[model samples]
Structure formats: structure tokens, C-alpha cells
Target: MALKILSGCINCDMCEPECPNQAISMGEKIYEINPDLCTECVGFYDKPTCISVCPIDVIITDPAHIESKESLLEKFKHLVNTDRI
Candidate 1:
């Protein structure tokens, strides 16, 4: 599944750099995760790097974009092949 950043973000700038797919970015008030670009690190890591680096533990699975592991892997492959990673 894709991940989403909750509202408690301090904008510490930790998660943004950790995201392998470049899915995290500065939103109007806090860091945001783009579901379309998020694969939960399926292709780059065993776990999500952004979640590991986030200090406040505000990152969580996006219920709106629920996806299976195999689906996430396919998305990762697509990002890599399309040079969007």
C-alpha cells in the first residue's frame, strides 16, 4: 500500500530525503506523500525508508490508496522504467 503523512509533521526534513521514489515533498503546511509515486519502498528497501526516518511516526498506510505487495512492486518497476524514480 502507499503511505500518507499525517498532520503532526514538524517539517524536520528527514523523510523527504529518505524516500527512494521521491514521493515525499513539502506541502502547504507539512510534508506530503504522493500516492501515485509511493510504493512503500517495495523496489528499493524491505521497509519504507520515510517511515523509518520520520521522528514523529506520522507516516502511515494510505487507506485511500490501498494496494497489495505485488501491486506495489509493479508500481516500483514502472517508476524505474519510466525514469521517475
Candidate 2:
């Protein structure tokens, strides 16, 4: 599933570097994740790095936008703009 930043975000800016897809960005008052670019770190890491480092547990799975692992992999491939993934 693609992730979303909840209101719990502390805006620490830590998650930005952790996202391989460059999906996370600074919003008006908090960090936001671009669902179109997020692959939940499927093709790049063993786990979602943003979730691993977010101190406030702000990043979370978007249940409304859930996708399978295979789909996530496809997303990762697209985000990286490569077929090698």
C-alpha cells in the first residue's frame, strides 16, 4: 500500500531522505507522501524506511489505496523510471 502522513507528523524531515522514490516532501505544516510515487519501499528496501525512522509514527498505510506486493513493485519500477526493478 502507498503511505500517507497522518496528523501525528512532527515535521522532523527525517523521512524525506529515507524515501528512495523521493515521494515525501514538505507540506504547509507537515511532510506529505505522494501516493503515485510511493511503493512502500518495495523494490528498494526490506521495509518502509520512512516508517522505520519516523519518530511520531506519522507515516501509515493508506487502507483506502491498498495494493498488492506485485502492484507495489510495478509502482516502484515506474517511480524509478526503469525496467530493471
Candidate 3:
């Protein structure tokens, strides 16, 4: 599944760069995560970096965009030229 930035976001700009897929961006008043680009760092890292650095724990899973692990791994490979999954 993809991720979403909840209302609790502090806009501290900590989670932006941590996202390998470049899914997070500044919105009108807060940061937003692009579900199309978010792969939960499945292929890039062991865990989601945005969630790791978010001080307010604003990053949360998008239950609506439920995707299987295989799909996420494929999406990650399409984003970055990585051989591992």
C-alpha cells in the first residue's frame, strides 16, 4: 500500500528528502505524499524513511490504495534502477 501524510504533520521538512521515491511534497499548508510514486521504500530500504523522520507521526498507510508486496517491488524498480527487491 501507499502512504499518506495526515493532519498531524508539523511541516518541519524532515520527511521530504528521506523519501527515495520523491513522493512527498509541500502542499498548500502541509506535505502530501503521492500515492502513485510511493512504494513504501519497499525496494530502496527496509522501511519507510518518511515515517522514520516524521516527528509528529503524520505518515500513515493508505488503506484505499492497497497493493501487494510484489506490486510495490515492481514499482520501486521502475522508479530506481535497482536489481534487488
The TM-score leader among the candidates is: 1
| TM-scores for all predictions | 0.96, 0.89, 0.89
* Ten contiguous residues with the weakest lDDT in model 1: 76-85
lDDT of each: 0.93, 0.88, 0.88
Candidate 1 local Cα displacement, residue 81, angstroms? 0.5
Name the best candidate (by lDDT): 1
Query: Which regions of candidate 3 deviate over 4 angstroms?
Result: 81-85
TM-score, candidate 2, is 0.89
For candidate 2, the 10 contiguous residues with the lowest summed lDDT are: 76-85
lDDT of 2: 0.88
Query: How big is the RMSD of model 2?
Result: 2.3
Per-residue lDDT tens digits for candidate 2, residues 1-85, read 8999998788888999989888899988888888888899999898999999988787789987899999999887776676465
Model 1 residue 19 lDDT score: 90
Residue 22 shift from truth in candidate 3, angstroms? 0.7
Model 2 clash pairs are: none
- Of 1 and 3, which scores higher on TM-score? 1
